[model samples]
Target: MLIDTHSHIYTEDFSEDIADVIQRAYENEVRKIVLPNIDSSSVKKMLNLTEQYPQICYPLMGLHPTSVTEDYEDELQLVEFWLQKQKFYGIGEIGIDLYWDKTFIKEQTDAFRRQIRLAVKYDLPIVVHFRESFDEVITVLKEEMQPGLTGVFHSFSGTLEQAQQVVELGFMLGVNGVVTFKNSGMDKVIEKVDPSHIILETDSPYLTPVPFRGKRNESSYLVYVAQKVAELHQISVHELARLSSNNAERLFRI
Candidate 1:
């Protein structure tokens, strides 16, 4: 069995047939799909999906880095409310994203630290969104480092050094469809990392793997990613699946 540690199929991308998507995920042995909330706009839909399929869908709450505007505190407050209200696998989909716009860097940093504090307080892992800002993300994480800080860098695409640093800091590297891309350069990175520090994810409705490239990604396609990572580690696909799933369970406690 496999667990898709990060996927956004709940974001209207699969609204028409999310059930079918979940079915396909289960059919492909993607037994669990973890959904991360983007902001206030996504909490209800994310919760609804988890409620609809309690056993298969798990929910995480956090403000995404891209959503870090001047009013990010409002969103963070809502995230806090949700955390206090119910159980979440982690505080996630949170981190620095200097890719799309660099204007809100300070806001994003503040939000990231606050959320990290929340994760520490809640005794939950964090799933980070470090897009085009790996150094920035790592810096903040280092500054806020404490006894129980742990999380995953979603859709991790970094060098062997960076991967080593992440694992050293007690974070698992979330590998996904990008690992299967023909020219993404993620394969070389994945090959150097130890499988014990790796976890599987699709980041679906986004980075669809090869052969299924250019198509809307879903949890079911994680197998293609699994196959690639397995090849990189010189292990069987099933073994990779078991190892990645175990890593994810340890990180998310799901």
Candidate 2:
């Protein structure tokens, strides 16, 4: 079975047909979807989905970089509240994102650092989301790196050198639908990486793989990603599933 290490199917995009989405994912052998929180506003819906589909959906708690606003501390407080209240598979969907706006770069880094500390405290892996801020995110990670600090860089689209850096830092690379894009060039980078350091994800409701590009993404489409990554590594899809799923199971303890 394949594990979609990052997905937001709990979001409104799937509200109309969540059951169907989960069923499709299961049917496609894409079992165990990880739900990463965006912010306080998303916590309820995310947790609700987890509660409803406890077996297939696992939840992670964190404040996304884009969600870091002026009142981010309050949001962090809520994140801590949830972390203390219940069990979470990881601390994630958290990192620096300069692609959209850089006005809060300082705040984003601060929040990222704090959340990484939370991951360390809780003894859970992290699911990072960095976009156009690889240097910034890597800097923070290097500064905060410590024993028991581990996680995956969700939707990794970095160079082979960066991938090597992440692996050296003891983190998994989250490969998703983007690898299937005509010009993403992710396949070339992934080709040089070992399967043991890779994991599969869909980032559902976004980054849908080819043959279904331009359509709303879902966990079921993870098979396309798996197929592509398997081809890149020149391995069977079944073997790819085994390796990536084992990476996910170890990282998130799911």
Whole-model lDDT values for every prediction: 0.92, 0.94
TM-score of each: 0.99, 0.99
Can you tell me which runs of candidate 2 are displaced by over 4 Å?
none
> How far in Å is the alpha carbon of 108 misplaced in model 2?
0.4
lDDT of 2 at 169: 94
Q: What TM-score should be assigned to candidate 1?
A: 0.99
Error of 2 at 220 (Å): 0.5
Best by lDDT: 2
> How many residue pairs clash in model 1?
0
**Candidate 1 segments whose C-alpha is farther than 4 A from its true place:** none
